[model samples]
Target: MGWKWGFFTAAMVALSVATWAAGYPWLSERITPPHESTSLAIEAVGAARSAGAGTWAPALLREAESNLRLSLAERRRQEVRVILLRNYADARALLSLTQSQADEATRTARLQRGLAEVEASSSLSSASLAVASAERMSRAIPLDADGRRHLARARSALIEARYHRDNGDPRRAEELSEEALQQAQDAVTRANTLAARYVDEEQIRTWRRWIVETVAASKKTGGAAIVVNKDKHLVTLYLAGRAVRSYRADMGRNKLNDKSRAGDLATPEGRYKIISKKGPNSSRYHRALQLDYPNAADLRRFESARRSGELKNNARPGGLIEIHGEGGRGIDWTDGCVALSNKDMDDLYPRIQLGTPVTIVGGDGSGGVFSRAIQDAVEENRIK
Candidate 1:
């Protein structure tokens, strides 16, 4: 009976020892310190904040930070720590993904803003250049009603575009600037076309031939001839077919066109003779040389226009065209007359006599002087 009882006690002690050994690892794991993954996750959260994740991934970062704090507070249990470590690893991976997406989004936005700025600047420059070109051409040529209207529209568009640009609307500004540039370009084209119509190539060639013939005839006769070039703003005195002198001159305010009636602010183009002269005492200018305007050809054209109803029945072809002094004002201010400086007049008045032939031509007698004049005006008016 004693031996049987000892065997049972030994068997019970062995079973108890085996059961204790099996549970020892489980208890040790529960009480152990948290894994390294928890620390790594905390560091990753800090890094994300430093990289601006707070602004770009606020919700994701907030949740991850909250979970990490909860896990750290309960870190005494080994099982709990292990679970927290796993959760932290997942949070870190999510944080990394969030930061990458945020970075990509920020880069894309910056690139778009930069490209918009470049386009806006380029469009503004193009619009400015076009407006400048249109202004210059308008100055050199006589813009008809349609041409004037187009230029006004272009200027209006440019002003509006500038307004948008200054108000911090880059997208609207870019679109408006492009529109302004196109309008300005169209204005220039219309103005140039209008100018071309007044002095076609054939007309220019005819004027050139006439100038040559008139100069040759004057030389043979030992008489002088006067040539007025409106585009060059010059009055040239030709003696015996030789250009003896050239003087800077100004014409009527609207000298781009030929005078067709009284009060027309334009200098007429024609052949004429100096009919008389007036000194400072008798003329408003320092001196004046009257020309025989409305000659036979002028009268015939006037009559024809009247018959065609192109001219008002009462509109008379005005006659007091003259070359006079009081110029050098840098602008055309005459009313159907050519003007020179007082000094230039003093030099020319003594040499020219009554009956001297005078010829007035438009442009350079080549139909190309207006183009050069437009270019010069454009350069002069560009923003300094």
Candidate 2:
């Protein structure tokens, strides 16, 4: 009986040992949280967020977070179960999947952010160049209110784009840069269209014909002639059919068209003659050479326009046009005259007398101001 009892006790001891050995590993693992997998998943999620996953890979980041939540829930569920019955296989799998999702999110975010940075930088450069080109065009061509507004808006957008790029919002920067580029291009287009007539070939040819006639008259009379080129911003002095001297000149505030009526701020076009000269004490500017603006041709055009109802009922063909002083301001600001510097006027005033031919024309049919502006616009559009 003693031997039998001992054998049964030994057998019970052996079974107890086997049970402890089988349950101890699971008990140790489940007694607390799934430290290894939980830590790995958390670290991976943190890495993904640091890589800008929230902005560039939001869907993948959300998925990673969701899987991590599920993993923690599964771990908690298994922790509450009896030690021998607990199985953390599902929790481990979820944690592993969460880590993978986080890693993928990190990779995707890095790639996308890199691409966006490159694109944003390229767009910003393009926008800056477009705005610069438009500004140059604006200086050469007079833009209406709407066209000027477009250029202003483009400058504002470019500034905002730079701000966003500095703030780490590359996507937003890219969008604003694209908007700036378009607005600047629009401004350029408007400038080109507005200056088209001034650069027309036929109109230039007519102006050239007038120049030839003026030069012929100078040669015949053995005297000097004057040619004012609005596009070139030059007043050229021709002595006996040959150019002798030239001076930088400014034109009327609205110099794009021929003078039509009183209060129309346009320099007169066509053949004219020096009617009178005013000294410094008498003229508003330093010196002045008055021109006969309402010649027969001007009267005819004014009459025709009035007959066609193109002008107001009371429109008058304005006179008192002149080549005067107080220029070199580097901008067109005259009422309806060609302006030269005081020194240039002093040098020119004595060279010509009354009835000397003074022809004012748009351009000399070369690559003038308007031509350069149109070419720039076309090239910029082609690049776009």
Candidate 3:
């Protein structure tokens, strides 16, 4: 009986060993490496956050992260532990999807922001250039009704664009800036077209040539000349065919056109000579350099205009146009005279001789005979 019992016990122990060996892999997979799926889910959540998922998919990310943490915690506890493999897998998959969506959204947002900034910058630059061009054109020539209207529109648009830009609406600002640029360009074009009616190409060419010749003559004669550009509101001094100095000047109240007669309030446009100079006590202004108005050319034009009924029969060609001091007022307030500051007059007084040439012309300095002449002479010297 003892032998039989020993054999039976041994058989039972052998069967138990075989059963444990067969189920070891299955038990180990279930019990060891706790929260493996949860860890994978956590890694996925981190990837999503790193990919900017927070910006585009905040709620989804929060839900996935919360579920993963809860699952991991429940897995650590023994009493209320639940099978979380499937749950963790689902959370990980969801997080991956969120990450992809967030990445795409983030990329799109960055691209859009970059494009907006570039467009806004370009539009602002273009608008600024257009406004400057329009302003220069307006100052040089009288703008017609349509030109004025367009210029006003452009200015309004530019102001609005600036407001929008300050308010953080870059897209709207860009649109408005583009509109402003277009309107400003249109105004410039219209103004130039109207100016063409009053100033022919031949006149421009003649002015340019005269300037060059005058500079050459001055250089040869070792003399000085004065040039007043009404539109530029500037006076330039040329000595020996080279520009020596420039000064701000104020013109007549109605200085846009050539003076026709006394009390016309228009500055004359022609060549003349400074015939006399007077000190502060001897003149009404601080100082004065009297010019010879109604020179030979002026008389010829005055007579012709009278015969053609362009000027009144009794109109007398104005005289006594001078460059004087005590100016510095922003606007043109003189009566057909070029006025300068006291300081500028003091500087000019000693440099000017009695016979210094003075030439007054309309429009910006670009087409002025004086500027062109100086430029040409300078260029020639450079070439030499």
Candidate 4:
């Protein structure tokens, strides 16, 4: 039980993700990150057809989630299957053990000759039952090491309990048999915990897979590619990020020194990956691209200062954030987050795929389109 929760979670996740089987031959169940440099997206199209999931045709993943959710609800209700498995296992174990005891009482079994057969059969039946239960739920929730210990002890007690009764110690034998039953009763709770955990794992796994497939389909739909209009000091969207819709945007008064620390008003310059997305509900901007802007370079720069105790606690508050719609009337001011017109947001609300990459730059800075720090990480080796 030391890590029972974690193990249960992982098993459940793997089980739930198994739910999304590609029906057609060509659609791939897997997709690699675009940074892999070799596009696996193209390969996935081939897999989709072979698997019978159909061609790389676009379908709304949000709708898929609805369908998947209904299926999953049905999957969870199969808890009855767990009880059926347990009953089957109990029946098999009891039948075998009872038969062995009857034989031994009649002198058909000896210490060395008969006990091993009973033990092996009992173990096999129990294991089979556990697997049956696992199959019905999501993942197998076999007894943990502690549970196994109890089960082993219970089996041993059954053997000894019967031995005592045959040897004229009926009360002692009854006590031992009762002890075995108690251990099993305790294990019932543990088994149920594991069963429930698989349920959660299934949910999380389902969501992540849905996100990947949805993003992939969106890519195929082909919006404007990302673009920047420097002279106008505005970033434009193409089919990808391009201005299938565009909005009037204002750049920092001075784009050279970006806002690194949370309070710094300067905008950041780098290749940012959107890690999280939230809807119109805003604590900050109106919907946002929460960028993973801080990199190792930024960390290393402040490390010495941190050791010397000169820098503020825990590096700069690192996200370079952005969202559509200016907070109020036209403003050329921002700490680092970008501002887009309300009209632009209405257009962007549906199209902005999560995990989209946004690159920042100096109005007239040198180096690559991506920030120097990010470019170095990508070229030096391959940074995640």
lDDT of each: 0.74, 0.90, 0.72, 0.44
Poorest lDDT segment (10 consecutive residues) of candidate 1: 84-93
In candidate 3, position 195 carries an lDDT of 43
Model 2 gets an lDDT of 0.90
Q: What is the C-alpha RMSD of each candidate to the true structure, in Å?
A: 8.2, 2.8, 9.6, 37.9
Better candidate number, 1 or 4, judged by TM-score: 1
- For residues 1-384, what per-residue lDDT tens digits would candidate 1 score against the true structure? 999999999999999998879975765454445455456656766665654545545655566566666555544333445542422334344444444444444444445555766788788888887777778777776577887887787788778877887875557778887777776666666665655534566877766776787798789988889998887788999988899999999899876777778788889888889999999997899999999987888888889988999999999999889999999676789998999999999999988989999998776544334657455534544212
lDDT (C-alpha) at residue 349 in model 1: 93
At residue 236, give the lDDT of candidate 4.
Answer: 44
Clashing pairs in 2: none
Model 2, 1-384: lDDT tens digits are 999999999999999999999977766665556688899999999999999999999999999999999999999998888866777888988999999999999999999999999999999999999999999988888888988998999999999999999999999999999999999988887887787777688888898899889889888888999999998889999998899999999999886778899888989888999999999998999999999989999999999999999998899999899899999788889988999999999999999899888999988768767777777678767223
Give the distance in Å from residue 325's predicted Cα in candidate 2 to where it truly belongs.
Answer: 1.8
| Candidate 3 local lDDT, 1-384, one digit each (tens) | 999999999999999998889976665555454444555566666766664446545655566666655555544543244543312233344444544444444555455656776788789878977776677666655567898998899999999988988776678999999999888877866765554423455665655565666667778888998878776678889899998999999888764567888898888887889999999889898999999997999899999999999989889998889999988675788998999999999999999999888888664436442233223323433111
Question: Could you tally the backbone clashes for each prediction?
Answer: 2, 0, 3, 37
Q: Give each model a TM-score.
A: 0.72, 0.89, 0.48, 0.32
Q: What are the per-residue Cα lDDT tens digits for candidate 4 across 244-331?
A: 5446665443333444565665455554555676667853556665666575555565565667776677656456566545533344
Q: Model 2 — TM-score against the truth? A: 0.89
